[model samples]
Target: MGKRILVVDDEKLIVKGIRFSLEQEGMEVDCAYDGEEALMYAKENEYDLILLDVMLPKHDGFEVCQTIREYSDVPIIMLTAKGDDMDKILGLEYGADDYITKPFNILEVKARMKAIMRRMNKREQTKEEKTLVKGDMTIDRDSRRVFIAEKEMNLTAKEFDLLELLAANPNKVYSRENLLNLVWGYEYPGDARTVDVHIRRLREKIEKNPSEPKYVHTKWGVGYYFRG
Candidate 1:
């Protein structure tokens, strides 16, 4: 079966354009015009990807993304009419997998969708082949599981992605922008604080002391590196 995608936008034209474009790429697409209906459809169906609009009746994309994160790890790409950086940053912080600005090229949108789907599919394909071990921590890429001293650690999807990226290349210092682009799969318009927050949260879960994180170390102004 082809991949299923959910398109949520209040604008009828936008929804139609996206549905048509994605369908041409051999994807099954569904649509909702508001956040309320979008949430309903999401609850009743399992989608491979969700294209969510930032401005919607009832809830808005940020809230919808946050609510969806409560129960699903399904990838989300937020759409916004505004070009404001804050809007994009908020969308990411709320768990959006990516964001598209208004007046976007349908081709670009399709390209981004294809890129994200390809990366996700590749991760699944190599799940069994990639495993990272550092000190007492073990990250199994196939199962998407992290363990500390054989005990499982609960990590958010984004947190796990960050750790995986860092661990995949141990001791390689990655700048904040690079991490955001590589792991987040989008250009983050906000300050580096988003990376800091996720890093802190990850440390609390994996480190014996969050203040003295051992696995993920900062290189002052350079960025972060995984100490394997």
Candidate 2:
């Protein structure tokens, strides 16, 4: 069966365009013209992915995204107008899988959609192979689940990638640049602080003591290492 996608946007034309593009790739598409309707549909149905617009009537995409995250982990890719970095960051911080600026190429949207879908699908495949236990922490690669004792941990895509990378190689010191390339799958621009933020977040979720992290350790002047 084709993968299912829910496209939520206030713009009818944009919805049609996205639906057309996605359906061409053999995906099943559903559309919602407002945030309230989108949230309703999302709550009642299961989708492999959700394409959500930032601006909407009634509830707004950010609120919808935030609400959905409370109950589901379905991947969400937010759509926003250009120069809306704050919106993008807010979406990401609230658990969005990705964001695309308006006036975006249909091809770029399709590419990102496919990439996000690939990552989500990959996590399913690896869910079974992941079995790295460190003290109270358990990293299950198959379901892409991380657990501290019996409590499940919620991690962003990048955070999960970082943990998987370090846990898979135990005691290996990977520099920020290396981690950026490995975990993010690209050469990150600007300072390597992106890695730092993710690590900090990860520590908060999985560490018994964030100030004195056990699984992930900083090698001052170097980068980070996982103590197996």
Give the poorly placed runs of model 2, Cα more than 4 Å off. 126-130, 141-145, 149-161, 174-188, 191-195
Q: lDDT at 61 for candidate 1?
A: 87
- Top candidate (lDDT): 1
In Å, residue 166's CA in model 2 sits off its true spot by: 2.7
RMSD (Å) per prediction: 2.3, 3.0
lDDT, residue 89, model 2: 56
> TM-scores of the models, in the given order?
0.87, 0.80
Give the alpha-carbon lDDT of every model.
Answer: 0.87, 0.82
Query: What are the per-residue Cα lDDT tens digits for candidate 2 across 89-172?
Result: 567666676778887898998887787778667756765454888778888876778888779998866677789889877889
Which candidate has the top score in TM-score?
A: 1
**Candidate 1 ranges beyond 4 A from true positions:** 128-131, 187-191
Candidate 1 lDDT over 118-189, as tens digits, reads 877876776554778887888988667899899999887888889988988889999998888888776765
Please estimate how well model 1 matches the true structure, expressed as its whole-model Cα lDDT. 0.87
Compute the lDDT of residue 5 as modeled in candidate 1: 98
